[model samples]
Target: MTTAPLVRRAHDRGIAVLTLDSPHNRNALSAALIADLTDALDAAERDEAVRAVLLTHTGSTFCAGADLKADGIGKGPGLLVGLIRRIATLAKPVVAKADGHARAGGLGLLAACDIAVASDAATFAFTESRLGLAPSVISLPVLDRVDPRAAGRYFLTGERFDTAEAVRIGLVTAWDEALDGILAGLRAASPQGLAESKAVATRSLREALDSGAEELVRQSARLFTSAEAAEGMRAFVERRDPSWAL
Candidate 1:
């Protein structure tokens, strides 16, 4: 099978490195890219030679999020969700090496991992609200990683948050000057133990969401059509701040 151009996977030091490769577009998660990632993750999970997985990207961005051009929308496919679900449940650790802006769906990918290490320059945002779209698929993962009130603020505002704010909000586990050193430390730990711990933590959150799925959808539907949401989208397209107060 031909490898997808959007992702490249390699194994070394018992760690499987999955590099998001679409630098031209800041590694936007097009449907083809999502399909490739699903396959790559499945392969990594089945390979006993791989002890842990490290997700990173090639360009200045870790990921810019879903390809808005392809889908005319930002939601991920079932396979993408399944891949994230497996990352949470995997018997091996999954670490995110966030090197740049992890926006929208990209933030979802980081939250799905077992742990995340970001450079001092890394930035995060939940920008879908500004584009007349809801972060329906990524909402649960973001909520799990950050405080409820913080999630509400950022998700509603679609504002960019820096590394310090990301750390403060609990979106990332660590911020470091050298990403290599942090990955080295994670490599020294027991992959099995990390995997088990992540599974336990994420499973609980998933279960709670499952029980409240209906209410969640209803709320999002309401927000999607709200006048505020319309203004947000218009402001974004017009390249001006939203006049929401008016």
Candidate 2:
């Protein structure tokens, strides 16, 4: 018997559709999933007909961050940082289309994209703090895209925010019912123009990640191996509040 892939890919017009299909774990970024996504991106990039990439999900939760059982935050930082950096620096425009919830490192994935379009039903949060972790790796992409004040609030509190709040804070590009217009726009643009524009737009984000990736990965490793993170992750996996929670 063969296992189903965590991610599925399809080509539509000039857009390469990469769907996160692992609903069982809320499409968490496991090693397998990340590898598959990276492979899909490589394939799309090599294809001359592909002008842009559209990232979407198949379940109620777009992504619930790292898979605690598989990744446990310990192994996730390096893998996640590499994947997100690839997205940030990809030559073609990558758009995230979300209609569900994105948490922790999952938020980083979408934020790394050139544009993120969420439906009104979409929700988001920086949930790392609640798990005795910081949004260290994700901060590279997220902080650059969002208002610092708002990032501080969500990053510290782990409070959930909706699409309207997301857009207001610049976390999401827009909250539309569908992505037809965005797809059409990408399809209409010339390939070279899209690549150049994406480069100009993502230059700063790329620089930030390039400069800080090592430190952030170290920070994540430190946090994940600590007693506090251990207890927090235990509580989370067991569906209970950590000892530190008031």
Against the true structure, whose lDDT is highest? 2
Q: Report the lDDT tens digits of candidate 2 across residue range 43-108.
A: 999999999999999989888888867766566889999898889778898999998999988899
| Consecutive 10-residue window with the lowest summed lDDT within model 1 | 71-80
Pull out the clashing pairs in model 2: none
Worst 10 residues of 2 by lDDT: 67-76
lDDT tens string, model 1, 1-246? Answer: 965467899988778898989887788878887777777778888887787788888988998876756664334444346556766667777788887999887898888887787887788889977766677767767778888899999989889988888888888887855556756765777767666766777886567456654555565556656788777767876899777433
Identify the leading candidate in terms of TM-score.
2
lDDT of 2: 0.90
Q: Which residue pairs clash in candidate 1?
A: none
**TM-scores, one per candidate:** 0.81, 0.96
